[model samples]
Target chain A: MNSQDAILPIAIPLAGAGVAMLLRGWPKAQRLWTFGILMASLAMCANLLNHVFSSGKPLVFQLGGWAAPFGISIVVDALSAIMIVMVQFVMLMGCIYALDAKDIAKRYSVFMPLFLTLTVGLTGVMLTGDTFNLFVFMELIVISAAALTAMSDDRSGTEAAFKYFYISQLATIFLLLANGLIYMSYGTLNMADLAIRIKTDALAGGPMPPMFTLAMVCFFATFMIKCAAFPFHFWQPDFHAAAPTAVSAMLSSVVVKSGVYGFIRMTTLLFEPFAPQLQQVLMLIGAIGVIYGGFSAFGTHHAKRMFAYSTLAQIGFMLMGIGWGGTLGIAAAIVFMVNHALIKSAMLMLSGYLASKAQIKSASFENIKGLGKYLPQSGVLFFIGSMALAGLPPLNGFVSKMMVFRAGIEAEQWAWLAAIGLASLLTLIYTMRAFQWVWFVPPAAGVKAKKDGDSLFAPTMLILACVVLGIWGESLVSIAMQASEWVQQPAAYIAAVNPAK
Target chain B: MDIIISFAIAVLFATGIYQLLRRNVVRSALGLVIISNAINLFLLAIGAYDGTVQSYAKAIGVRSDALPLALILTAIVISMGGFAFTFAMLYIVMRRYKTADIDAITELKN
Candidate 1:
């Protein structure tokens, strides 16, 4: 495939968002247009992934024909390609579920356009090879996602949106400061160029400026807040809980992955010399997130809130895997990231579906108690999703979790391993407890189920993916290995971006 | 010049943080705006001023970098959009709750 094709995934959604906005007068046309755009982008991503893997090189597109280190470069390596495909796939599912959920469709005329814009932002974030471009794309994501969250039917949605918007701005400000610091010291905003400069400087035995470490700290704090790790996770549960069901699924599944992506890019590409040290810190913070998120999730009674806390815990698991800091460890983290994205999105959508069927249209246990009995299909789906989330056998979560466990063992990180084990036990306890309460508990008096006609196709498709990936997980593991190897050795990525060097 | 710019940035940051910690939602929003401006100034300072030449005119002598100007402009635009959205949301929130106090806006809980 041509290197120019790399921009299609980002450009298509962006242009399509404009078109979707115009078609807003016709909801039917808007839905079709949005769906068509997502499918086209997904195809483009798949094609790009195939090209990158087959050629064994990153696909680099220099914007406006300007060379790297001077102009914007859009690079699609194996890791970025994998992440793009996963995110677009999840977005497509969320769109499908949103279309089927009548309340959202009826209330929000701008949903389709906003959703398309969000995809554009996400794809741009995944593709951009420049730090400044990453910041720009991140802003795009924050704006669209905050708007989507504000459009939730719940009155609390606006409050959640405000909180999300304000906190995200704070994070981005830190990011901007970090970017400025990097540019000041290295004289380049292009990631590949910065990587080369840092490497060369280290080889020359030069002392790094203290500003560099401060920049790293800023980067660390920005991503941790974005990732909703411990101590910075206060905004997540309320934000996720207040968002619309499909939006909630998207937020928990792929949106938060942007933070994880930043960490990966930082540790793997920008600050390679500092990785070993950062990995230890990441492990410590991740372990704390695991315990805190798990216990908080168990303590919560709201369905969406519980899942949000669980998201914190799952992100912690991926962080610990990343902290293991070898080819195997990064691969396991990739596996876990992909698996958790699918399983968590499915669980969120299922919860949304059940909430839609309830009289009060809330995911709180009090409103949704015994509601699953009326929707046995969703009940089965939720069971599979929960089991998968808890890393049960014959599910994708189990395979990824096993990989993470293996990575920890190989790394000989016994203390972190114990933390992971305890977190796993906690995950099991919380998920099963929520499962029992929702599916088995008797309905409290005066709680009645509504005759909602929302389709279960979205969550079902995701759950089916979980089962399929679980059964045939070797392929995913191999792909994760390939991606991780590309990540570990940045030479190819740097060369692809700056061929002249 | 470096000391002056650093002092300015420090002062702006302190004021921004103070406003940000206020109980009033509007003040906090304005705090964000102030902080963003401070960051923009910091970006400018990081470029290390060279007043010998203009950005538009490139001479054989020392030329000042224009990239920081571009970066600051971008930051200004983004922060402006963010503030506009934040104010609009605050207006809605205020109208709904009839208060600008953040502590009173407690609709969402665990």
Candidate 2:
């Protein structure tokens, strides 16, 4: 294995975060440092993706050259590589987006450090093979996110961060307890080793203890909050809406995704036997989240909070996709994960861009009126994202939504199909209502029209990518299928981490 | 002895949860600390091979599993850091808003 490929996705950002903070006195240097680091990480992910795909197997690197199930192991499979690529790409854009925001750069010296730490934590989450290590990285993520949330200059930012921090702490406790239970039962913390033992037990006709199910339940409860599904989704709107625009892009696009990623990891790799039952429960909650988020989106006139609710709804679709339970169904879920990251991040950034330009301070529906005619570029970007999210034809959102429909039909789940259909209607309503209110409504007098510049680069590139994905839907679908293969076939992942019998 | 330790853990966890659900930010921070200790106890009790013996034993038969001890050590350090961060944030939140009640701290438009 190329050890650099296994390690640099995390190490580079960690090293850069230190350098960025040291050079905090120089904002320009910080920007350059952040951009260079993200680009390097992106490039590394590209190389690793090529290596993994060409080798036609996952790559495992045991830290300190220790054997599996003993020392820490970092596994870079198709799914991990894909997620790294997505994260690095968005982070690179977030850096550029942050450059234009200027508010963050001027006020906070720790932005680059916190951003890099967040990146490191997330990268660690994707790569680690040990559940304990996953917990460690998760704590790192929570701390970094909490600090960043508090970094927001507004009182709302503090409040939102406070809420997020507590919820995360509660999740952390659950995860730790689950880890204890699993460790006590299995005698080893390595995921592949656990999977091997589980298989061995099943083959030997041994029964799973009730404790196993209880542990799984605890783990599931944690990720549900992470996914912000259903009842646990209340904190999402306030947190996302209060963050700095670029931070919102990161949070909405990839940070929240760690939860969904955790759920997928548990179901496929560690807890497959209980998945059917858990996924059914997830399916019901997902439907509730979908409808709840959609209905809640209509109640908010602020662009950011509306999108936050919409994200809750999108998560429902992804969960429902996972719940559909087949190769195509899981693949569809992965595809939507990718598309939502792209489309939603772009939408959130566009709102921030518009907010900066508006006469009103925030992206409220009332203040940002006439932007469709006045600021045609942002209006267009917002419209495209809105249409895609609302599942319009010829958009990337429609592509993934189509796959979800296909997955539902193939699984013979008419109820899921009908639920998705209803959610789609609600999505169209909120998105269009927001769009119509922004562009078609008359502007208040004395609104200062701001000109678009290099700042437009972030949303434009993002929207273009979404459009490209839509037009080349076939390629995206096939790639998603390959990634989901990592989750669909547990043996592939297990074999990569533990090659020896 | 085992049952007692387990009951104690439950009580600590319950108190932590209750304190967290309180309206004040300081109570929330205190709850965090309390919960951290509860988690440590939970891991310790779960790792115990014998409730009758002392936690550390060099003698082979009476020895406790060392893994949870190491894990607890790491968790303690991490939780300390977590507590420091939380307390510092709490101070800042209090100073900035001039209030400890979280309900009164609602300024962000949702």
TM-score for each model: 0.98, 0.95
lDDT (Cα, tens digit) per residue for candidate 1, span A69-143: 989999999999999999999999998988889665346778889898899888888899999988888888999
Expressed as tens digits, the lDDT of each residue in B10-80 for candidate 2 is: 99999998998889889977988888889888888867666445545545456456677777887888778
**Which model scores highest in TM-score?**
1
Cα misplacement distance, residue A122 of candidate 1 (Å): 1.2
Cα RMSD (Å) per model?
A: 1.5, 2.6
Give the CA lDDT, 0 to 100, for residue A330 in model 2: 82
lDDT of 1 at A175: 91
Chain A TM-score across all models, in listed order: 0.98, 0.96
**Judged by DockQ, which candidate is best?**
1
For all the predictions, what are the DockQ values? 0.82, 0.52
